[model samples]
Target: MQQIYLDNASTTFPKPQAVADAVYQYITHAGTNISRGTCATTTEDLVFATREQLCRFFGGEDSKNVVFTKNITESLNIIIKGLLHSGDHVLVTAMEHNAVMRPLQQIGTELTTDNAPTDAITFSRIPCDADGALRLDALPQLVRPNTKAIIMTHASNVCGTLQPLAAIGSFCQKHNLKFIVDSAQSAGVVPINMQEMHIDALAFTGHKGLLAPQGIGGFVLLESMIDEITPLIVGGTGSLSHTEHPPRFMPDKFEAGTLNLPGIAGLHASLSWLQQQGIDKIRTHELTLTQQFLDGLQQSEAQNLLRIVGKRNCRERIGVVSISTDITDIAELAFILADRYAIATRVGLHCAPNAHKTLETYPTGTLRFSFGWHNTAEEVNIALQALKEVLAHGL
Candidate 1:
């Protein structure tokens, strides 16, 4: 059977040919590390070029402001831990992943220090509407005097609901609150202008919309945030060699040890490819596939057996679509889809239990089908047929 992969929200698969080639070339030919050695010209050149490419891709002014990490979870951890101190309250949306929630939970319990605020840290969740869209109007009422920032996801990984970043960013700017966005689901698939959107920080993963391999993700922050935010890890940065402490620089201050050269190389190639293809074009293609899938679902005989999560409109979302069924065993359905039809999907809370709670899908989660640049309308029809058959078979 032909395999149909629809888990782009988890991680994109079948990355661009150039991405795989770049990784292969880097591993086979260049075996040196960046920032640690002076003689590795190829590695150094690639590193610099990758940074420049990322800066341009994300609309960041300074290349130094882009710091690499293991993944978006690590990036979010670094930001949440480093930026929030005692007495600093943060406002996050109900759609935040475990990446954001867990770190904030751990930090809120800690005591204050001299350099930090005297009071303990606090977090408030801005609620979402019935359609999983963020309620921006509720933001003003939730803001506290101690609120230091508003951290949120640009798009829901579970439901594909696009948050109003510009509106939220404007609100943050008006209130003097820092705006940190988790672009794990939106980056490379959506247009993000840091300066125009008033975004202070953005966390993104490489394996998703960026089309790079896993284990590479990072964030782009305004240069001004460097001094205020603390570093998550401290070690050799290959800069200020004489000093015991990590160098107080843009990326070196945050990045430590050997970087992911292979992943970066892959990312560099994917960025180049994405740049050539254009993000808007990629988005349009994915949205087209999404609509095809939605239309198939609506046209299917199993329509009564399934419930599509979020809004019916594709313009308000990316390519992600979550579905619930009258059948209680959603995982079993996913298994059948996989084992019988070779349709791979993600079924569960999707690492955002809070988001499930907001959607009232807690305890029992929804089945998610996320589209990508490579998915075609025919594949979506096949998936719909599979779902119809599964429903006909019954649990």
Candidate 2:
């Protein structure tokens, strides 16, 4: 059986050939650490080149401002833990993942068991509509004088609803608050411009929409934020091994220890591929597939067997679709699809229980089927047919 993978939102599958080749080339031939003037291969040059590539891909003004980390979760931790102080407050949406929430909980006024946080960071949650759109009207009311930043996800990992970044940026500007974005779900799948969007910092992952290998992601921040954020991890940066103190420079201030050269190589190649393909073309293809799936689900909604969990239409949404059904347990359905139909999907809260609550699918979450640049219309049709068959058998 040909297994159909529909979990791009978790981590993209079937990465482009160039990405894999780049990783292989780095591991096989240039299997050395990156330090300037250290290796004849100029491995540092390749690393810096990838930094520049990522800077350009994400609309960062300078390559030096790009800092690498293990993944978006770590990037977010660096931002949340390094920047916000004892009196600082932040605003986040209801759809944020554990990457953001877990850190915020540990830092803020919330009570936690393991860690005692010195930073008394407080946060407010901006509610979302039934369709998973942020309630921007309620945004103004939630702002406190202590609100230092707004950390928002560009796209919901669960429902794929695209947040209003520009409008939110405008709001942040008016409120004199920093706009920090988590672009894990949107980095390569959608266009993001830091300057145009007035973003102070943006975190991204390579394994998802960027179509690169896992274990490498980073954040780009404006030069002004350099002084505001403290480095989470402090160690050997190669540039400043002389003194025990971490480097005060842009990326060195945030990045410590050895970098993931293999993942960087893969990301570098993926960025080039995305540039050549153009995100507009890629986004259109994914949207076309999403629209196809939504149309089929909508036509069958009258049966009361399954219902979409987020925006009914295709507008302002990614290719991630969450569907909840009364026919059978979503877990069982997912297993049947995988075992019998050879269709793989993600089922559960998707690490965003609040998002499920907003979509009215909490406690019992939805079965999510996400599409990628490689997925075809045929795959969408197959998924729809498989869903019908599974639900029919349950009935």
Candidate 3:
């Protein structure tokens, strides 16, 4: 059986040839560090060019404001731990991943003198409708004087519902609240202009939509937020060895330790490819596959074979779709899809219990199918047929 991969939300598979080549090229030849006064193959100029590429792609004001981390989770941590404090309150969407929720939970418990925030952080979950769309109008009731920032995901990894960043950014602007976005689910596929979105900070992972390998991701923040967010990791930045403290400046301020040169190199290539392909072009192709699957699932739903958990349509959403059925256990269904049909999928709470709760899929989770750039419409049809077969005939 031909293997069908439908878990791009976890990590995009069959990455662009350029991505792998870039990583291999770096590992094979250009083994060098960024701040330790770079070597030939990997220069400070080359890495800075990657940052510049990201800045241009994301519409960040200054390339220096961009900071690299191991992944988006770390980027969110640096922002959450750096910006929020004991008495500070934040607003987050109900569909946020543990990357955002867990850090907020872990904060305020530890009292730090100068490194990180010690005060316990409080937050209210902005409710999402049963379809996983954000109820942005409820923002007024959730904001407080202590509400320092609004941190949220750009797209739902579980259901693919997109929250309105422009509207949320407007709300933040009107209230003077900082806007921070987790773009792990929507980075390369979605067009994000920080200045236009009024986003103070945006975190992104390169492995997912950006088509880069794992262990490489970061964020870009406005210069104004520099003073507000403290550096989470402070050590050798290779820039300022004179003092024990971290370099108090952009990039180095938030970026400590040796940078992921290989990941950065891969990201550099991926960014170039993405722009060459055009963001709108990628979204159009992925959403086309999404619609094909959604339409097939809708037909299956009409026959009572399965139920789509989120919006049946692909508007204002990415390529992720979740389905539920009373026919068999969802996890078991996923296993059967894998074992019998070679269809890969993810099934469970998906690391966002609150999102499950919001979508009324808590306790029992849905089997998730996510489309990607490499997925063909024929593959979507095959997966749909496989779902129908499993639902109709047990084992």
Candidate 4:
């Protein structure tokens, strides 16, 4: 049986050919540890070139500001833990994933008491609407004198609702608060111009929207903010070998030990492909597919049994859709669809309990079908038919 995978939000499947080729090529030929070897001149060039490519992809302000981490979670931890101190207030959104929430929770715990290790970091959550969009109007009210930064997820992983980043960026600029964006779900899939958006930092993952392999995502800091934040992991950063102290530079300041050259090489290739294809085209294709899926969901009788989460209009959302049904257990229904129809989807809280709570799908989560550039209309139709069948059988 053919499988229809709709779990791109979790991680993209069938990554671009360039990504696969780059990974294989790097492993086969340029298999050398970056910044460590003296004779591997070509490998060193490849590493630097990959970094430059990432910088270009992110709008090319400074290649040195981009630091490769294992993934967005690590990138976020670096910024959140490195930049935030006790008594420093952070503004975040209700739509953030656990990657952002867990760190902030730890920070909040630390700020409350001296014994709490992280007592210095305080935070306020900007509530999102039922559609999972952030309330931009509330931002001004939440900005306090102690507000050091505002961290926001560019798009909701659970619902794919896009945030008003430009407006938020302007607010942060006017307030002199640092603006950090978690682009795990939005980068590569959407257009993100840091300069235009006035973003101070952006954390992104390579595997999902970038169509690169996992274990190769990172954060890019603004040139001005690099010196202000300390490195999360301190060690050999390929520079300042004379001293034990970490290098007081951008990427070196944040990046410690050997970099993920293989993954970066793959990411470089994937980004190159995206550049060639153009992100706008990819976004349009995915949006079209999402529209097709929404239309199918609306026309089907299954719509009555299933409540689609997030914005009802496709214009306000990305390529992800979450649906919950009162007729059946969402997890069980998801399993049935996968087992019986060979349709793979993510079911449960999707690592964002707050988002689920906001949508009132907590405790029992929703069925999420996340689209990708490769997802076809026929596969979406199959998913709709499978959903109808599952409801017919179980509900």
Across 1-395, the per-residue lDDT of candidate 2 in tens digits comes to 98888999999998999999999998998878866445735677788898898888878889999999999999999999999898787899988898999889888864234544345777878999998899999999888778899998999988899999999998998999999999999999889999889999999988999999999999999887889998889988778667988889978887778888899989989999999999999999999999999999986687786888888878899999999888799998899889988888999998887888888898998899999999998889999888877786662
Q: After superposition, how far is residue 367 of candidate 4 from its true place, in Å?
A: 0.4
Query: Candidate 3: what lDDT?
Result: 0.89
| Pairs that clash in candidate 2 | none
Greater-lDDT candidate between 1 and 4 = 1
Query: Alpha-carbon error at 353 in model 3, in Å?
Result: 0.4
**What range of 10 consecutive residues in model 4 has the weakest lDDT sum?**
110-119
Give a tens-digit lDDT track for model 1, residues 236-281.
8887998897888778888888889899999999999999999999
Clash number for model 1? 0
Residue 313's lDDT within candidate 2 is: 77
Residue 277 displacement in candidate 1 (angstroms): 0.8
TM-score of each predicted structure versus truth: 0.96, 0.96, 0.95, 0.95
lDDT of 4 by residue, 1-395 (tens): 98898999999998888888988998898788867777667777887787788777776489888888999999999888888877788888888899998988876742333453233667778988899888887888877678899988999889889998889989889999999999999998888888888999989999999998999999887887787677878888667788987778767777788888889888889889988999889899898889888877776534486788887667767899998888888888888888988889999999999889888889788899999989998998889888887776663
For each candidate in the order shown, give its overall lDDT on alpha carbons.
Answer: 0.88, 0.88, 0.89, 0.85
| Clash count list over all predictions | 0, 0, 3, 6
